[model samples]
Target: MKKLALAVVVTMASSLCAMAASDVTKSPPPAPYEQVSKLVKLPDFLPGMGALFVDPATLPAGPFLAYDHGGKLVSTIYMLPIKDLNPDKRFDNLAAPGGNVDHVDVYYNAGHPGVPEPHVHVVLWHVPAADEARVAK
Candidate 1:
């Protein structure tokens, strides 16, 4: 069962990486931050989550690209609203916009700007756990 899940995740990652191939050479890949910010209200930088870029239309299920201070792609985040996680609902095939995730972290968030509803943040970290401190406030 775990192997099946791993296979599925790998396939999705590969697909996303291919879709991003044109931009991958650019550090962080999801630039220029200003253009992305125009589409969504992205902060200068988000502690722990790093700088983010997401299309408002894809909210809640965002493959929100996260980047480090030096513009390194660090993680891909998904903000899943608590109300939507019930048995009837499933967020399947959620893409990891930044490929090669080193690990994943899921945590509850009561609410915040841009995402005001209570939600869970599914963070797919591209860096090793030890390197995550790069985004610490």
Candidate 2:
């Protein structure tokens, strides 16, 4: 039910955004949520909820879709700049201090064309920070 609603909202928003002023280029498609999810082996998720869309080319990282058991989007994952995060461990190194801290999980997103710098994004489960930044706009 939640996915359906979200899809509906996305469809409507896309339609409206399509009617933008002639000066603006239409928005690119959202990030390849499923592909990225598989790439990182998201620690948590719900069926069909993986179909999230955030263009990776512009943003440094992600709001990788995380769903609660009910299939509603509960959080996001995105990469911070490598120079800032300065992580010493690999992206998939779940042992890192930030990996699972504060309801968030971190993962490596290397060699991905969308990422400008090699860095990690976090699966911020139930974290208002991620949601506050992108969603609820």
Candidate 3:
């Protein structure tokens, strides 16, 4: 009877340990922005100033900036290619009739491995009316 009780206790303990280990490994990994935000400082020009978007479930990363003519945030720039960007192609298109885009900056993960894979930090800046130096400010 003593041996049987000991065997049952050991089996229960082993089963619990296996369950805990599986839980740890089955959980999704932490998001990249959570990791990057801790390391880098986003440029001051960034309007909404916050962590860039990066859904691990989705490949690539983005800190896209899409604002209205009045400087209101329209939406975040996703991973759409430059060629596919249309209708609102030029900086003037995004700004109010009179208001010009000073510059636009986007952050991404440069280390992105490839399609369906992970990446590192990547930043894309667009200055429709001015040069890089002018845009930096």
The backbone clash count of each candidate, in order, is: 0, 8, 13
Full-model lDDT for every candidate: 0.76, 0.46, 0.36
Instruction: Assess every candidate by TM-score.
Output: 0.74, 0.35, 0.22
Candidate 3 residues 1-137, lDDT tens each? 99999999999999997664333111121233232222344432433332233334333324333333333333333453444346865332221211233444455433322222323222333334333333222
Task: Judge candidate 3 against the unseen true structure and give its global Cα lDDT, from 0 to 1.
Answer: 0.36
Please state the error at residue 2 of candidate 3 in Å. 0.8
Which pairs clash in the backbone of model 1? none
How many Å off is the CA of 124 in candidate 2? 0.7
Among all candidates shown, the one with the greatest lDDT: 1
Best prediction by TM-score: 1
Better of 1 and 2 by lDDT: 1
Between candidates 1 and 2, which one is better according to TM-score? 1
Off by over 4 Å in 1: 1-19, 22-42
